[model samples]
Target: MVVDELNEGRIGLEEMKVGGIFPNLKVFKNKVKEYAIERKFVFVPVDSKPTKYAVRCKDKSCPFRISGRISLDHVMVKRFVPEHTCSGTMRGNDHPLVTAAWAADTCLGLFPCPGDVRPTLIRAYIKDKWGITISYVKAFNAKIIIHEKMCGNAEASYRILPAYAEEMERCNPGTIMCVYRSRELWTGGDSTFCRLFWSFGPSIRAFSQTIRPLILINGTHLRGKYKGILLAATAVDGDGGLFPLAYAVVENEMYESWL
Candidate 1:
């Protein structure tokens, strides 16, 4: 049961700090794992207790075992057998670059435009910070994964469009919002996204008063899992500023979509 609990990867009560002053068992264990991973080593737990914990390198021939004791106010290192007879290079989730959560947090503040995030930039950033190199494929996948983490999935977002539109109309009266769905011929039943159009009340009022008679229209392809196009209309204000009138997401930039 103890081994199973340890393998479950959850921090137990024994691993938690009693007060602000005392050190946590999980904190000590994480620090040990962090140290080993940073130095490119793999370890397995040999023994675990409330007051003491011990871990040895996975390599059978290696005599490395890091053992420490939990004290009243601090964690104390009891013994350190720092010798590994392993021959293989470093691999696995222990590496910082390979973990999705870590990668997401690392790139969260850096990439404002998810589409512009490149593998080369991610690799360069990781190398500069941690002095570790990751493969281009890994970096690319990390970019996508991090973006998904930051923004909800495209399909899921589409599902909630109706609720969002309803909320907008409720919050601001005179808001014009429409969602169109079409059934696939081959599927015979399931409905797919056709088009979505929305114009906020404030924007409609503002455009009517301060915007020019001529409206500029444009469409851009959405580079997401669900391929689509975003169409927008804007008018110039009296002060030469761009005033947004309305926008729509459609299957394509067709005459029907514009209408």
Candidate 2:
């Protein structure tokens, strides 16, 4: 404990609570994640690189910085994973911890919104929870396509997010939020996931109707500590089925950040 680090409360490295001690670090992590989201707290992922300099340079216009990096590659979902999931082995599909799948489970909330069944309400709910709204810098869309979108036989490339402190600090130059870029569209195997899930409820029904409702979602890490953006679409019909139509990873949302 930091108390142990200090001599009888005397000044030591610095007085602080021990962030982790028990093997169940996840206990504290869950508390922090929920608190952060509910409080609209933006978390900056720690940079992995050792800082040759004290604090990172605060140049807003630095290309490596958020203010300068107009096209943030860090927006991909892959960047959110941690060290434990992959014994540090495997590539592309090799994260021993923090997969994009895990991120979604966390951000969906401990409970559904009392009245946020509407896409607009869902949008409002997410905005209130994470302090972000629809914008192009973090533009992700959900459009109902006539056909399914499967990349199994298609050419593709995905992002690999940085997991270091220096890179993270630079990525979030303003030092307010973090970006974990990704392309995790949840289109079902059916001809249309949108139509398949109609009539689930008022929320799902209304959500299913929007052919192109801009959806912003985030996946929770397996350890359930981190969260990131997930943009998806749904279909609306007489019965109201809300199926995932399509989606992409995204980032920064200024008042002018509409998709």
Candidate 3:
């Protein structure tokens, strides 16, 4: 019932704010805890398993790497593992397994496109939130931003995207894959495709049997509706996938074209 009476109640928590003891705690929200404290450290505990929401370093050299990000489809909730070894400094940044993985990117890309390439939430967290230098290539575990329009019952667009994705894997086996959408995929002046593939190509192979062994295609239509298509094709790879793959459709009736 009173401030001095709190200790008599035998509560274990110490360092109650001044206002918290009183009726109105809003005035004490800004008060500091008198206990020992330090800044947010830059280390993940050894043996600590991180949540899907945790960030990975954008540096391929960083030791604290993360697994897949949380998504509407792959709604994973797993324990964390230390990105670095339990003890000792890391060997180097490029040591593959022991080293970290990054999302190598030369340009800023929006996401849910399926391409391993993308601008990450880590980039936003670093640049916008933390003001840190986030590397596009090194943030292997960062979540790429997705267009709300691009996500849907197709399970956030990742479900139906596998068709072209199969081709991307077939053609560019080692490369990270992606999917995007556009309302219009025109074909002319090297600018036939809609904005989805506006920046994409004149591939090595045209739409023929032997020439069109592999493909990747999707669209990120501005309307955010279910009305776009994309495609990419390539030679079969050792994995029975394709090679020299492009990523989307640049023409009309693309889904039908795939048929």
Measured by lDDT, the strongest candidate is: 1
Q: Where does candidate 1 have its weakest 10-residue lDDT segment? A: 13-22
Q: How many residue pairs clash in each candidate?
A: 0, 41, 37
What is the TM-score (0 to 1) of candidate 3? 0.21
The candidate, 1 or 2, that scores higher on TM-score is 1
- Model 3 lDDT-worst window of ten: 30-39
Tens-digit per-residue lDDT, 81-191, candidate 3: 334433333232222211112222212243436443344654553344223354555454333323232333334444445465556556653444444444344554321
In model 1, the runs with Cα more than 4 Å from the true position are 1-33, 42-58, 65-82, 91-97, 100-102, 105-118, 183-190, 208-210, 238-241
TM-score for each of the candidates:
0.65, 0.20, 0.21
Give the root-mean-square deviation of each candidate in angstroms.
7.6, 23.1, 20.2
Report the alpha-carbon TM-score of model 1 versus the true structure. 0.65
Better of 1 and 3 by TM-score: 1
| lDDT leaderboard ranking | 1, 3, 2
Look at candidate 2 and tell me the lDDT of residue 138.
Answer: 19
